[model samples]
Target chain A: MKKDVPYFDKVHRWGRIWTLLALVALFSVPLVFSLAHDAWPEPGPFLKGLVAILPLYWVSGIIETFTYTPMIGAGGTYLSFVTGNIANLKLPCAIAALEKADVKGTSDEGEVISTIAIASSAITTTVIIAAGVLLFSIPVQWLTKSPVFAPAFQQIFPAMFGALMASYLRKHWKTAAATVLIGCIVVFFSPSIGIGILIVVTIVAAVLTSFLFYKISTKKSAAK
Target chain B: MDFKSNWLMYLLAAGVIGFVVVESLFFLVKAWKRGKELGISKQTLVNTVTNSAIYSVAPAISILATVFVLANALGNVLPWIRLSVIGNLQYETVAATSILSELGGSLTEEVTDPAKFAAVAWGMTIGCCLPLILVPIFCKKIHKKVGDVVNKSSSASALADVVAAAAFIGIIAAFVSKSINGIEVTKTLTGENVVSSRAGFLSIATLIVSIVVYLLLDTLATKKHLVKFSNFVMPIAMFTGMGAAVLMTQLLPQSLVLWSWPWLPPVQ
Candidate 1:
């Protein structure tokens, strides 16, 4: 926030402070609940539960940070991860905004677009969800759970990625083909593949294939 | 009703959820102001906000539906807190279910023990906190290094774009393959493992239908020049695909698909 500080530097400074606050806020819910009700977790059950879930989610957390941080930019990464729904809502929405603007995601213009779009998505979702809980809980609950709507809820991922994948594949088939092929091979071996591992493997494959394709296309052009 | 639904529980959830709201607003304002200073038109920035909001409507509604399901065990406030923060339906459900099981509690049953309830909340909390912690420490460094590498040459810059697109393709590919292959990820030692899978022909049908409708919408927007209507294309295509799901469930029979898992019914 200092006048001499650059915008990018300022973002990191404030982002660290806010992120630390958010982390504390995240843990406070249960801590306060225990204090208010005089209810404490029995150490054995708590450790058992923690042991089962922590390693996998944490490893993916590590993977998600590395993979998505570069793509979404610093500001986008800070906001989107906190607001959650990175893959489904935040990442796709930011990429789509960048696509619409015809800017590269690595550009400064791309950072502004991604941050604005992700922040908007986060606020909009929070408002809608808050409204649902406070004002329209009954109708919202019934409507979403109704037979007519249940299938839609369960199948949201396929519904979302169908178009998104098509749009990306159309423009970047050279890289897309490589990644998708690798992803399928992995899936064939393990039908229910861990998303973090899948992303890591396919991304590595993509880098190699794209380099190969890039070299070939350039060589052909030079010869011509 | 259990202790999870008490008035104090709602207050605690609101406090945490409120923090997220404030965090979002703080970033939204900062970005909006930065966009203006960068000489990006106000109209363009406004369009981004509105268009992004329109895209969010479907996903938010679907998320609320998941909240209702989670509410059965942990009550309304806890699900609201978890979902509004860094957790999703699948992750939250699995975390809470396993934690309850450790305490000899059932997620399908109303939790009466305050200690067990507190444990579930703690479990969900610790599982998702890594992102928030890791981001603050590492995000600035990662962003800058990646940007610096990309700027080294025109070819490097171009490769950056391909790499980003490839990341998206990598994720979507896993999802598409899951639908085509019959794979259901129940929580396991690693938080996700495939215990059962059905012949997921029904999901394949939905995926195809969605792709077709989206293409049609793209045609309408680009070929027909429906500029104003373009904003609704993604959401419209999404809902239409949902309609396909309903139709497929009603008309498509389990017997019709080869290797179909007999238990993978249309709905829970």
Candidate 2:
């Protein structure tokens, strides 16, 4: 355990180093393209495009860091942010890994498991997308054009969420019930609400509900 | 150089993908070695790798669908690189379309000019790059703060878990809510009120089927005490639900099976 302490510290040191490196690499994609083509983005339209999605991404990115960091732990958080696909792929995979390993997210074991899961998923997704790109014309065309495949692809979100909800809702019924009710009303009425805003709203509702539930239960026990 | 599809563009995209692969593998190996040191069994580590990889396939394929969709407009290489990196189908499509439309162009038509293509690509890369930049800066501090709160009391830890669970529930609920949009009634051209969302109905049906499958398999896994089976229930349920969605589309009326709805905006 004493030795393991340095391991985590080392992870943080290395994680930050690797993340900074990856950041430079990612930014260089556009930079390289612009240099290679000798064509820079037009300022007016680029700013307009940036403005359109900037607020949403900025808000969501900040909110997600807060919301997901505790759930996935340190190493997982660093890898997942770089790898992307948090809500849909990485989070669920981490949770599943932790559950399978019988580890708590706050524990050292949990951090390691979550990181392994996320890293593996990231690799798988990247490799598959790369393959899809290489085979663009025939396989991709068939997958998109085939009538049998279209409906299955379209319902991916629902299928994913349904399984995820079933696993999670069993233990946190109170929180699940409250947030689901609120989420449903929001989605049904204001369908235009983006996923980022919806996530923030849900987090607030969950925290408040949990606090209220804790208070009520404590009061009941005190009365007893 | 053709702005649409060029060998140079493919090489550039490959470079980005190659970098991601190397980075991902680096962390994966580091984490795996650390897990072993932490006394996590080799079997547990193997299961994590296998299950996560298997679970990723369906979603990865769906992402491929997005790549194809965007390929028509932005060309294959750029969309491939974007989707493989931090960008999802929704964000990339929206960012590209927003920039293209603002520049007096449409996604349906390819951006022939190199400048316009660069603008859209740069817009997406910049807009979505926040998470990568922000996470490294704040993750350690955030984890320490949360860990402090959780360690303060047993009740606090419980509350924290509940909060996490609730967040997950809320996200799932939002997705499920959109799935039921087909049940909503709206006025039609013939003055006959009808359900306006065939696609929604399909989604809802798929959700229900998947949930049932997940629950049933989970029950069986628990009863049988099958540890491996437990790890796989979600992916199994998702595939089942997706198959059911395809079947539902065939059985249901064509008018009810929509490709897109007003409430659930298209990626474009």
Fraction of reference contacts reproduced per prediction?
Answer: 0.66, 0.69
**lDDT by residue for model 2 over B132-204, one digit each (tens)?**
7777777778777877887889988887766665655666666666565523333222223344343355777
Top model by lDDT, which number? 1
Worst 10 residues of 1 chain B by lDDT: B259-268
State which docking tier applies to candidate 1: medium
Local accuracy of candidate 2 as per-residue lDDT tens digits, A92-209: 7887667667777777787788888898999999988888778655787687669988778778878888887777666667776777777777766776555656767776777788
Candidate 1 overall Cα lDDT vs. reference?
0.77
DockQ for each numbered candidate? 0.64, 0.59
DockQ of 1: 0.64
Error of 2 at B254 (Å): 4.7
Q: Which lDDT tens digits does candidate 1 get at residues A174-206?
A: 777667667666767776566667767876787
CA lDDT of each prediction against the hidden true structure: 0.77, 0.76
Winning candidate number (TM-score): 1
